[model samples]
Target chain A: WLHHPASVHQDGITVEGLIRRSLEAKEFAYCPYSRFRVGAALLAHDGKVFTGCNVENACYNLGMCAERNTICKAVSEGYRSFKAVAIASDLIDQFISPCGGCRQFMREFGTSWDVYLSKPDGSYVEMNISELLPVSFGPEDLSMKKVLKIPNKY
Target chain B: WLHHPASVHQDGITVEGLIRRSLEAKEFAYCPYSRFRVGAALLAHDGKVFTGCNVENACYNLGMCAERNTICKAVSEGYRSFKAVAIASDLIDQFISPCGGCRQFMREFGTSWDVYLSKPDGSYVEMNISELLPVSFGPEDLSMKKVLKIPNKY
Candidate 1:
């Protein structure tokens, strides 16, 4: 729930480096419609960094966000635990924040990890996943008992 | 847009076979959270079939639906145009319909493609993406001129 954290992340990587990689990851974006290229560099707990770019589809909702793509790339490669993820966009004035969907995707791993929202200028804002999605739904919610359903057909 | 199509698909595959593949695909589901396994078998115009199972995450929203997984798997392997997609679930009596997100995802390629919603007991229904997500937002919407935003900060 930080308004703006320090320049150095607790994970030992400089914010500038992660943000730079995220910006570089934008080169792989396949956005032909909106042309809003986004990139993310995810730091796995095992000391590996996975970079990903937004992959847009003709169906807007089917487009994969940069953050989620980065996470999925890591997960597909068998890296589940994350340390931090830095997101970058072309905006120079405003910091790039993750969409609600990406927030939930990042929260799937852990809440305490760092989320760096950066602009092309390298300036950034920081927040944890829990801050982005407060009072969130997690895996435990699915384990609850099913409620009664009315038999009336719609 | 269909309500209940025949047992035969226009692409030359039988409905029962596709549904059976979907059911078999469910065996690879990685849903440790919800335990609600779902599977999808996507048929490409080139006569290739790609199957995928739901891959859930600890964060509920991060869970990838079987439909999307199937699409991504196909896309990753260079199959773009889809002819049909059959979905299956363990429910014995009720057909398994795609969620709002999945419906939007399917509409990315085309609306006329077949979507088979099948149950464990072999009973099923059929529909198209147009019927599932009417008046859907798509890639074209992003090309419109941007609306002016209010300057007031919250």
Candidate 2:
């Protein structure tokens, strides 16, 4: 059985249900240029769920990725820690992993995060952030500058 | 006159010529996934130039931005400090700025990097990284972590 980090069933919420919601959100994807639609669902540390889709632009450089969009949405709403993420793309026949850059971005949020990918039949594969990004770089590598900035200078 | 921070040009290297080369590199863009191709040129600290284009994927989340690709190529080749960058896109009619994520990635290399947006008429708009990502987050922010391992600490 595919495990959702946190399942919701108030009034109307289920794994299949949320996946469908996110898939519907894919329609809002602004991929006029690429025609590849993607959607992401994020579960916050506090159990709040937020969803976002790729927002493309005429200037492709300015376009936002589904993962980045979800991160920005969570950050803007004041959520820092993430418990889970689900990404879906309708273009390919099989599920694929997030790109290197997205892995870096996801690492910025935290390493304990879990990621899910959906099969066409609605089943999914699950993995933790560590599995996705092994030996990642993060806030820890910048220690020297902080030591220099502190007034104590000890 | 435009300023380049860490550029190293040979006896005959010109910014105008580099821009043209970057534009040509746009043809190599793997944007069948996004259909919006972008190419970038980086004038490195060692008087060498690097060029790259967006490599999109069927899984939209697995694509790299033109700027990130250029930076990664330079970093992989041992060039961390960037003097200037030129970006050209085929889809957008107006100037397109790098997304916030790219801005932060650029900051990781150097906060004072120079950025140029190329125009079809052979002219370009030059701006520094500070102007592009004002009050940006950088390596310094990473130093505040409670533990070096991130989310694992929680």
Candidate 3:
């Protein structure tokens, strides 16, 4: 398993533990449709861990990925800031990275958050959120000053 | 609120109740970034109700939409088929429809699933999943028989 050193590790758990959590989460995935199971584990700034597995719907558009669900659980529990997230998928041969939607979603939380993409073997490559979603649209773009205000002084 | 005559109305709840659930779900949205709150409610085949609101992440791509999250909750609870879904957003002037990704996600469950798009005032319009996402990709396309087998008998 190849490991890129994680820049911001949270909690006392080793990276292997985080990867294992993601792998464990995959068991709960409800992916009868695509049969592509994915799991994710989020490390909150407060040292709490949140994990989720992909849940597919009969309607393809209603499917929720493990990464997003993990974040949702974290947010619902009132954890906003995050240190890192590890994602695992059994699709071998290639690293399973977060989808574009997930990359953008994580951008809404922290630009420097570490993202670990892992294979079934627990080996992972690390990339920061900024690297995953460069030049992203964010909270600043939705500010009233930028969205509702005129460009120059009247 | 304008109500569409639902072809498959499960439970005795009026269509307005479903739309209201969608609107109510929007209250719990964790959308500090976009400020565009959206809510969704799903009516399971068993007449159970599941609700969700947009949960945004620092990584914008990792955000979960109300529609998808509601479906995920239902599926996680062991419900497979759905009767209908209602979505509400504060964005006025036009009715808020599911995003392309959501349309595709919902398509995974049932093509004929009723999708109601509503405004805060409760005014809404209705369309089926097939209409929202025509010529869609689905499970049949990913079947192992079609994926791994040769086209004719050897």
Candidate 4:
């Protein structure tokens, strides 16, 4: 069923080369801690492809996943809007999804953006960022004006 | 004086190229959301330099700091131990230090590791990881055997 990439209507966006790039990106993962390699590729509105691999750290929490890394790289390069993203992991039996932290990160961009989850062999599933992280918080939540109005307990 | 790098004794680790790299890395920060740019450089045991810029996401928490990014890149490339880390930010009046998350992340490598906080013009202050993040939690605290024994509330 994964054959027809053009037919997979994810908010009217097609999955053309993201899956391949995601798979290719896996080779760059630095995951000695978990031994779980993950790769991600993002397609920007300008048709630019940004790819990232999981970079693990001795401190587990400090590690960054492939999806977040890709988004970070894309943003650093000045691309704000994204069309689609594809993620691939080595887990063949089950499709792995973006973690809570990454989902929250993705929500900062666009909730309607397409997300593809894939296994080693390229077989995959698709979902939108909204479905992955429903009712998420964003820049709107960090209201400095509201915070300053709180009475000092001390 | 800032000119004499050797005088900046950060727990006995001398300030070398870290300051320059940190400043240069700042150019790549993706911080459209916060507009707070940060850059970091890590010196590995082998004397290799890994640099990173703060990569922000739409979900603020999903953002990766320059310090963590440097560590991730270093670790992913197969370097486990680190010698010193340098951080640079745009905050000119005060030297910007690593946040709590980055501090906890740095503690994973070594408590005594040198940490340098710098401004745009290369003026900096130095501290060790332990001093920055005291009474920190780490992998050791996650003793699964002990946690498993705790009775389930449900």
Candidate 5:
């Protein structure tokens, strides 16, 4: 089973406020080569928040996605479970979903979590992780029996 | 600059052989997961050789390290700007590297390609799509002045 919770802001964190924060975080993007900017925020299970932005490098394959970056931030702080995630991008107005790699990493935390996408106007859409990763694999799929066993023994 | 090359095998390939094939691909793991598994190999990177393995996840803040899986097999396809990729698991000898995450996604392809992984006996591996992903997020990062300007308007 999975857990999902709603997302909202306190102390008057209006739509404009959220978008601005995303934009501010955008400045932190490390796209040395590719100038695309992406920012993300995660609402942790314990009520704390984590923020991140895209980081790029000269080697195209060495870059990290914004979604992954946010999750890594939360993990680095010792937060394993999540309640919601919010993402904003300079590329599109219509909300976009996390990349496939991001979705897989999200599953590792908990298959049932909420995700929010922000628009330039501050309006947003909400989704569940399961909706994004339907019929997916988890640690259970690699059961202990399956993982622990070897081919043969003497 | 990082040497991007190809990998190869001189055998008639058996299941056992495939596992070793995949194991060799694990060397260049970008795994932030700390669960290290190296899958490197000798190939013909335009007549050169290279290797790779699984890279783990990062919070949406930092990122999972990059270019671990597909690079190994990339050299084999003769494309060389990373033509393909092979994968191996970081688990105890019996596991396979290519997961649904690697197949349904994990961008490393020019055209169709081959994959390999290890088995329980250090004797075999598996093979599948070397060019697993088709559409990946490859965008040029436009600068802030370009980004802030509203698009398609006077």
Candidate 6:
């Protein structure tokens, strides 16, 4: 556990190349509207890495975060389980953090996966999905039993 | 404008085939979690239609709304401009409404496009993007001038 330099590294999670790939992916950010670029590198359970950058839309709320972009691509490509995800941005004062929507998206798979929020200088802080989204709403609440009837209120 | 039936049709916007397509698309919803299915059919400016159903993830927040799914698919297929979109759901008591996230996603294109929120009985309520999300944040808010420098706070 390299706890010095004010960085938290997760147990058994190798972040050596993940952080760098996220930084590289930031170059592809289509953020003409925000001018705020972000990138992510997601490591699947099978050891494949998916890199993605923020794709902003004309409507600010439609803008997809780097974390969600990579995760959704991985999901669409048939990757269900993931090991870790590393995020990068140009902000030097504080390490990059996933937005609320991205946090929810990351929580969709499982909670124990590592998330590396890194700075341009490679310093990083690690946290799991549960820590990021406490008391989260997941699939269980909607589907309890095979015969659970939800209140029909749209 | 079909006023007495409580269904509003936009001037020169055709939604006859769109509503049926949306309802048909609902059969394909990948919603093992919520059990609440939704579907959308988007009409591009070039007379093409794209249909999508809600794709739910084990993570509740990661669920992609049908409206967004159709719009994103259309956008990826080189359809930047759209005329209208019709949404369908099983709830017959009231017409289905887009979630806050989908409303924002729909607003990404423009404020003038029509949205037909429909019930299983083929009745619908029409509203525009601006009516759904008022005083919205858009591209102009971020990129106002060529020399606008945003506050550098992460």
True contacts kept of each: 0.30, 0.18, 0.34, 0.40, 0.11, 0.27
Tens-digit lDDT track of model 1 for A9-127: 55677777888889988877767777888988988896688787776776655677888767755654456789889999887788899998888888777778888888887778778
Candidate 4 docking class: acceptable
Give per-residue lDDT, candidate 1, residue A121.
78
TM-score (chain A only) for the predictions, listed in order:
0.88, 0.78, 0.88, 0.86, 0.80, 0.86
Where does model 6 sit among the CAPRI classes? incorrect
**Cα lDDT of all candidates, in order?**
0.78, 0.73, 0.80, 0.77, 0.53, 0.77
Q: Which candidate model has the greater DockQ, 2 or 3?
A: 3
Q: For residues B62-139, could you state the per-residue lDDT of candidate 1 as single tens digits? A: 678888777755654446689889999888878899998888877777788888998887667888788888897776
Candidate 2 yields a Cα-based lDDT of 0.73
Residue-wise lDDT of candidate 3 within A1-154, one digit each (tens)?
3465453354787777898899988877888878899988899998788888888755555677888877876664457799899999988887789998888778878799888899888778888999988888777775436446566976
lDDT minimum window of 10 residues, candidate 6 chain A: A1-10
The most accurate candidate by TM-score is 4
Best-to-worst ranking by DockQ: 4, 3, 1, 2, 6, 5
| TM-scores computed on chain B for all candidates | 0.88, 0.83, 0.88, 0.85, 0.44, 0.87
In order, what DockQ does each candidate have? 0.20, 0.19, 0.24, 0.30, 0.10, 0.17
How many residue pairs in model 2 have overlapping backbones? 3
lDDT of 6 at A103: 81
Model 4, residue B87: displacement in angstroms? 0.7
Report residue B151 deviation for candidate 5 (angstroms): 16
Clashes of each: 1, 3, 39, 1, 54, 1
Question: Per-candidate RMSD vs. true structure?
Answer: 7.2, 7.8, 6.7, 5.5, 9.4, 8.3
* Comparing 1 and 6 on DockQ, the stronger one: 1
For model 4, what is the error of residue B111's alpha carbon versus the real structure, in angstroms, after optimal superposition?
3.6
Q: Candidate 2, which segments miss by more than 4 Å at Cα?
A: A1-154, B1-12, B91-93, B144-153
TM-score of 5: 0.53
Q: Per-residue lDDT tens digits of candidate 5, residues A1-154?
A: 2212333455344434444566567668877665566788777776676778988777876798788898998899899988777777765535544665787788888878876666544556666677665545466645433323222321
TM per candidate comes to 0.57, 0.57, 0.63, 0.71, 0.53, 0.56
